[model samples]
Target: MVITDVNEYRLELARKMGVTRAVNVAKENLNDVMAELGMTEGFDVGLEMSGAPPAFRTMLDTMNHGGRIAMLGIPPSDMSIDWTKVIFKGLFIKGIYGREMFENLVQDGGADSVWPRSLADHYPSFLYR
Candidate 1:
């Protein structure tokens, strides 16, 4: 399951990545969607890529006890967190920064830079104006 802001492109990407469920967090009731995804109590793993504070909080709130959350979002410096829940739930939080390995792979020709370009070209009408 994947939750993201209302964007068909993002949903398509998640579907291609084998996501069985994709919830548009920007539309309708998020709690209802979470419930539909069986995230009522919480989730086992939550990956936050959206930089919105609310999204981060929602992810935290919807995480199961002893669950892990990996965040790549860049929140504001003065952002607040519910430390009480963190401690009580025994949640594991991991923060990631930089693209060292990805850069290395690009530089070493292990990955192709033109791949994205090709994909974009393949769906020009869908991606471009």
Candidate 2:
């Protein structure tokens, strides 16, 4: 439920969208926020929408054991991370290419329907509507 962005405007939007915590990683320390929220272990799941390497590294650093991450963004170039973290933490990372959506939409018509409703259900629908 905690979301991080360097952009203040995006963080504001995330707060309005009902995120439990919206952190500007540029100005605030994520560890402090995690401590405040009593997340002594770390996040269980992460969605990497930003292609920034630093953000990806931060996600890796802040995940708990057996954490799951779904990456949608495509990085422009190669980036390195602490492989030990991934190996020892046993984190699961998945690259999400678009093909999976076709299968999902076919298997469950409900998946096809959720996109339009998701804006109203979870996001700031007023902007799009």
Candidate 3:
């Protein structure tokens, strides 16, 4: 899997974690990297965790038709994007507010995992009902 980050340290960490490719966005162009990797069709899947409008826009621009995106980061304010890209590309963007309760997690047996339990216990009023 390819991972992109502005921080060199984080890119290094991703490399250590065995990502197929790790890019430092501060120094290199993402599209150039994609072209070098022979990804002429663009990315098939994208996880948007930065919450930056530019990053999100780049993700939208660099996605292939029928690409799936999971947006987990919460933007600080309102932003705009090219709706034509979404319409013409037929991109599937799912906005994930917070990881409280989700059927997918239960299906994957992650609901019973210690991470969710810890989150629930830490934020009882928000997560635990």
Best by lDDT: 2
Clashing pairs for predicted structure model 1, backbone only = none
Query: Model 1 segments beyond 4 Å from truth?
Result: 38-40, 97-129
RMSD of 1: 7.0
Per-prediction TM-score, please?
Answer: 0.67, 0.76, 0.74
All models: lDDT? 0.71, 0.82, 0.78
Cα misplacement distance, residue 26 of candidate 3 (Å)? 1.4
What ranges in model 2 sit over 4 Å off? 97-129
Q: What is candidate 1's local distance difference test score?
A: 0.71
Model 3, 19-108: lDDT tens per residue?
678988878899899988888798987889899898899999999999988888776677899999999999998888454336655776
Rank by TM-score (best first): 2, 3, 1
Q: After superposition, how far is residue 9 of candidate 3 from its true place, in Å?
A: 1.6
Candidate 1 has its poorest 10 consecutive residues by lDDT at: 110-119
lDDT of 1 by residue, 71-122 (tens): 8788888989888878998999888746863575488663542233434634
For candidate 3, report its TM-score.
0.74
lDDT (Cα, 0-100) at 70 in candidate 2: 84
